[model samples]
Target: MPHLVILYTANLNFPTEEGGDMSGLCRALADTMIAQRDETDKPVFPVGGVRVLAYPAAHFAVADGSGDFGFIYLQLRMGRGRSEWVQQRVGAALVASAKECLAVLLTRQAVGVTLQIDVGAEVFDGKLGNLHPLFK
Candidate 1:
């Protein structure tokens, strides 16, 4: 149940002509999530459980109240069970991928990218989907 939510400022240049679009970012991140493995060499995150969603914040303000600044915040929410080492590994991989995807914009503009992992302790988490079958 690793769901990645990407929130980026509208000022940033997304969907670049070279195919650095939102869908491309999602594919990169989902691939990163699926590539993670535990110490036992087993998959860290389920392939069918990986979900990546991106949204642009049209109304926002970056550091120093300068509209020229842009930012991207990535939050990965997953069910609580994995060890700290696994979490850290996954986070590092994801952050690297995100940065790589945004490298051009980062160098050209005032942009900040941050990623965090949030282990959920949900009281009642429900789900209904047929995606697992497709993965099989």
Candidate 2:
């Protein structure tokens, strides 16, 4: 089965919700995403055991104490290569939601409008794999 890795981020100084307010925002975004998926089939959002990561930028620790927060990824983890359309759709939705969530949590200047999403496959360590052992 295909799995999803979700990362939820927020500014350190970005006012923390006292009564689980932030959770609501996350749910809203997730719900929005689930709604956009093809309902004719299966559920997009994970029912349980969802992988989540948090990325905190050093810049967010500036004088005002605003931590630049972001999610590492919310990508599909499957044996089969992820489909372009699926990645694009999910990425777009996540980015939009993150930016909106940040804006609501912090000031416009503090919340960056741009989001950068990358996959491990996009980078290499210059190490040869078993297939290239003989060649090396």
Find the candidate with the highest lDDT and give its number.
1
Candidate 1 lDDT, 52-134, residue by residue in tens: 99999989978888458988899999999899999999989998898888777776688888898999789998989899778
How do the residues 8-92 of candidate 2 rate in per-residue lDDT, one tens digit apiece? 3344345454322345445655554554453345444433323333343434233344444333334544333445565577668
Model 2 lDDT, residue 8, Cα: 38
TM-score of every model versus the real structure: 0.92, 0.44
Evaluate model 1: give its TM-score.
0.92
Candidate 1 residue 113 Cα shift, in angstroms, is 0.8
Off by over 4 Å in 2: 1-11, 16-41, 55-79, 113-136
Best candidate (score: TM-score): 1
